[model samples]
Target: MRKRPAEPPVRREPEAPEGCLTVAIRIPVRIVVLVLVVPVRMLWDALVVAGRFLNDALLRPLGRALLWLGRAVFVWPFVALWRWVVVPVGKALGWLGHVLVVVPLVWLYRYVLTPVGHAIAWVARGAGAALGWIAGGVGAALGWVYAALLTPVGYAVMWVLKGLGAVLAALGIGVWTALAWLVKYLVVVPAVWLYTWVLAPVGRAIGWCAKGLVWLVSMAVTGIGTALYWIARILLVLPALAVWRWILTPVGRVLAVIGRELWDALGHAWRVAGHISLAVGRFLGTLFRWIFVEPVRWVYRSVLTPVGHVVRDAVWRPAAEAARSVGRATRQALAAARESVRQARADFRRMLFGEPRRPQPVDRREPSGRETRTLGSSTTALTKD
Candidate 1:
């Protein structure tokens, strides 16, 4: 015997120990949930059964009929139109486009445009080479002119400007030195003395007064803010925090546990109700089969089948054979009458038109009557020489 594979162990979380409060809450919650869920579950199962019955008995057949009707009314006509009319028309149009437009465009490109493009390219290359040679000659002339004529003139201009710049720079240095000495005594020295002795002492004294005033104002503001902070914390924040921590948290936890237990119990009850509904349905089906179906089946087998066989053997076979005999006699009489009518019509035509000329047979084969079949030169299907 083959060894069965060992099943993997399922991992489960360790359950927390329940207190009296949790136990007290869970039991009532579960009972209430079960009571509430049972009727709803049973009703749900009943609806499921009713829906399945409707689907099988009515809706499925109706949908299939509608689907067939839709195919006949909508889909089949369009498919036939597409297959018989649209497809052929589209293929004809595609062939016409290929002949009228695509073929002409391809011919123009290959035979006309290709040669023209090559000729234009060759002309452009010649023009470009000519222009490049002319540009090179003009560039060489400009280089010679710049080196021979512009170089000496540019050097002479630069030398003259440099000498002038040195003279101007010497004069500028002397004027700058005189201006600096005059500015030191007339403007810079008095400004420095006034700032160091007069402005510095006044600015320092004003800054010290502003600092003292700011410190006094800040100290008053800080004392008031500190007092308000302590008062608000004691009156509002601390009470709200205490209520949240000590009262509301415990109440919320209990409510949460109750809700969780209620949800679990509802699920469990629904499952149990489903099993009960299934059992009840099976029992009812068995009872119905015994009460009605078996009796009908027995009647069909024991009573109806024998009576039908007797009727078929005693009455139906003789009636059917008589009907067939009558039909065969009728068909034979009609056939003889039709043959007499055709013979009369043929005799009348012969009297009117005289004897008709017989048609001569014409051979339609690859080799003419005068040609002989030779194995080495055969073109027929049997020998593809």
Candidate 2:
């Protein structure tokens, strides 16, 4: 019976769905990873290789070419200019400056200025020496004249003054003595005699009367003074005292308090006004700087400076050159005139003196007798004249 039950397992077939078929595919993990990641990695590697190629093939050569071009166009030319043109030009300019300006300045200072200064100094020294000689001669003449005339005159005048003073002193003493005697006799003696004789009794009576009158006047004056004092006390002093005590003191105190308060208020107002004024002033300063000062400065810098440069170059430089030329011409004319004058002076001297004498060195020896006689005669003639 078990063998009959163990009949062949029924071969049951799965039923097919009616709509869509769903298929399941089995893939290896390595294949999935390779399918997802390999293409991205390969693309990244390709990009990197392409970039390296571009850098090596294009960028390196381009950078090198640009460097060489910059050197050829800019750096090399600049170096060459600095070495050949600029350096040589600078050296030549320096030499020209030394030759034209510095050398000329040194030459003028040494040859012209120094010689002119020495000539001026020598002329000054000669003039000074002449002046000194003339001054010495004049001083000697004045001394001789003073010794001959003024000394005796001064002594005589002094003696006359002394004699006159003595005589005046004697006269004054005698006059004073006479006046004193007259006063004693006429005034003092008469006064004494009159007092002793008739004037004594009369004077006594007058003095008594005068004393009585003085007493009466004094009593009247005392009464008047007392009345005036009392009147003043009642009319003026007491009223003034009362007014001061009652009205002026209280009014003054009230006024003082009011004035104090007013002064405090004024002080506060003044302080506030000062603060406002300072703020206003600051604001005005800033506004003025921006509006006036900055614009003026901008105009000066942008317009006036360039205009000044133009004026200097166009007008002043040419004017200065013309002035220098005129000055040079004038100097040449003056030098020629001076030379002509010198020649004329020499000719005149030669004509007058029958040929100008050669200059001789000064001798410091004592003059001979003949020379002394001639000098004295000339000095005498000059003094007389």
TM-score of each: 0.69, 0.24
Q: Residues 153-215, candidate 2, lDDT per residue (tens digit)?
A: 999999999999999999999999999999999899989988899888998999999999999
Per-residue C-alpha lDDT of model 1 across residues 1-385, encoded as one tens digit per residue: 9999999999999998988887787778777777787778878888999999999999999999999999999999999999999999999999999999999999999999999999999999999999999999999999999999999999999999999999999999999999999999999999999999999999999999999999999999999999999999999999999999999999999888878887787888788777877888799999999999999999999999999999999999999999999999999999999999999999999999988999997855567768887656666787764
Colliding residue pairs in candidate 1: none
Give candidate 1's TM-score: 0.69
lDDT agreement with native, every candidate = 0.92, 0.82
Identify the runs in model 1 with alpha carbons over 4 angstroms from their true place: 1-7, 11-14, 20-35, 68-87, 106-144, 178-218, 312-385
Total backbone collisions for each predicted model: 0, 0
Scanning candidate 1 in windows of ten residues, the lowest lDDT window is 376-385
